[model samples]
Target: MSTAALITLVRSGGNQLRRRVLLSSRLLQDDRQVTSTCNSSTSEPRCSRFDPDGSGRPATWDSFGIWDNRIDEPILLPPSIKYGKPIPKISLENVGCASQIGKRKENEDRFDFAQLTDEVLYFAVYDGHGGPAAADFCHTHMEKCITDLLPKEKNLETVLTLAFLAIDKAFSSHARLSADATLLTSGTTATVALLRDGIELVVASVGDSRAILCRKGKPMKLTIDHTPERKDEKERIKKCGGFVAWNSLGQPHVNGRLAMTRSIGDLDLKTSGVIAEPETKRIKLHHADDSFLVLTTDGINFMVNSQEICDFVNQCHDPNEAAHAVTEQAIQYGTEDNSTAVVVPFGAWGKYKNSEINFSFSRSFTSSGRWA
Candidate 1:
């Protein structure tokens, strides 16, 4: 009786040990599989941020120092503390901006970038015509208007549209208060971008200022010019008693005045369908493919097309360098308007850089004056 009881206890203990061994083996095997996947050359590349170490350092998007020497603005903090995960640091130091007066007596192009909320960032460019008043007002007030609306509105597109319309109304009121009645004619093309959670990109634009995204060495335009050349825009203008007339260069203008069918602070042409309503586009960013986002006024756009700009920026080492290169190139290409460019780096900032060089010996069509 004693021998049989002892044997039964031993057998039970053996079974428990076997079960523990099997479970440990399975756990170890799962870990090995993950390691293999991360290290495998055939498998998709892995981001170093997710490959954690015990160092406890926060993830960062760029190591580049502060871009501007004049303004000592703070760099953006990582979202890890708020999001409960290691989100990349989106720093203003990594962003680039450049502006030139070009042939204009005074630069009417304005651009800015800022951290709007914990999870959102703002970038914008404004091209003013008739005067710099509209661009100046937008550059100063656009971010504040969007920030004020964010607590009440979650949809960025709606916030941008409302902000634009509100700014237009406010500008009209401000103009009415001024002794100068001609402020009503001051108008600007506004292009604004909001980047949320380092992925969601929403852009709102009125007139011809553009926002372009570069993904995998390719350019994806985020805005369409609000010109009378577009059949839909032309029809809308006509319905509002506005007529489209072309200049000597075949560039169409609304009511033979404003070049764009939509803009901010064009109170004098309000009845002629030059509205302040913005067209918005939202995109989910893929960090592995998306390199950067660039916002430009027509000065750069008219002289250097999107692809050319993308290639030009791709050759640069950092966002700040890229911004200067694009705008400088525009001036070199003979743009007579005030030129401005802002470059914001993304996850693939240095990943998809262009190794091949490009050359442009031919003068720009505008400079050559061969409108044919």
Candidate 2:
């Protein structure tokens, strides 16, 4: 994008960025290091599938391969209740991730899902926009930043908010350190999903990487895209002294540079109304139909709609391979960008319909029901 560098978070309510600058220069595409770091998955409430290349080639620095693997699971969540009766203990069934670099010179995407404690499950996706540095930084440090500020009393939503803002602040500090520190304009979108106390679901997001909740074969969108074209995001940017303009083909960009309005880096875009404040959404697992949760980047969602994803998951032979199915489909359908997906199934095969399922986003949470 346009590298017109002068920007600030505080606006004077004046037209500091002229409209003429939009046409001054063509948007330059930075040929970044195809970093394995998924740029980012950003949003207050947030939370991928896939391989693009058909070679079954292994992951490499330049190109090719699938990095699909299962994460730690079977951690027990505290017991809950159903219909005023105490429910039995709950544990994870499975968690899996898959990714493909597609046509890019190098893959700049990264993903991970881990069981933080007996009761908390953490998953993340990073879709880097400008370069790999921001995504790498997030993949490496986002959780640490969040956990360092979190209190023991359990304010999950507030912790999410602080965690996102912390990354922005930390990145800014790093950028100011030296001219050679990092790309001041590099940024990534990040999505983080938390399943806590076995039942509560909290999604915090910024940027485009999306999360979906599947229930009885139906798809429920769990995050909002932070692209500049969205009405609410446009207004938020304008209020912060940033202006949205259409590039040559009518795609929206903030200050004629960045495509997304919210992220963890792109320090130059901060003053233009782009921010890292994620909008969070909370859900309590109360449906027996709440089959599983799918996390993916734009590489998958950009090519397929919500229903298609639902149907794909519903037909999976194994929840462990759900991510592979999603990413593999994304490539077959034509996704030129990096693709990644994470799947978290509720219970075991043939046992889901007969399992206990109760979860809430609030302080007081409970759930216990047959899986099927």
Highest lDDT scorer: 1
Residues 297-348, model 2: lDDT tens digits: 9889877677777667666656667788888777766677799988876522
Residues 1-372 of candidate 1 have per-residue lDDT tens digits of 134422332233223344235434544554566666665563454323323452423322222111112212222233332332223345788899999998779998999999998889999999999989999999999989999999999999999999999999999999989998778899999999998876679999999999999988899999999999999999999999989999988989987888899999888899988889999999977655677899999999888999998999988888899999999898777788889999988756767667786656466544634432
TM-score of each: 0.78, 0.70
- TM-score for candidate 1: 0.78
Quantify all predictions' global Cα lDDT against the true fold. Answer: 0.78, 0.65
Worst 10 residues of 2 by lDDT: 61-70
> Quick one: RMSD of model 1?
13.0
> What are the runs in model 1 whose C-alpha is more than 4 Å off?
1-87, 365-372
TM-score of 2: 0.70
lDDT score, candidate 1: 0.78
Q: Positional deviation of 34 in candidate 2, in angstroms? A: 69
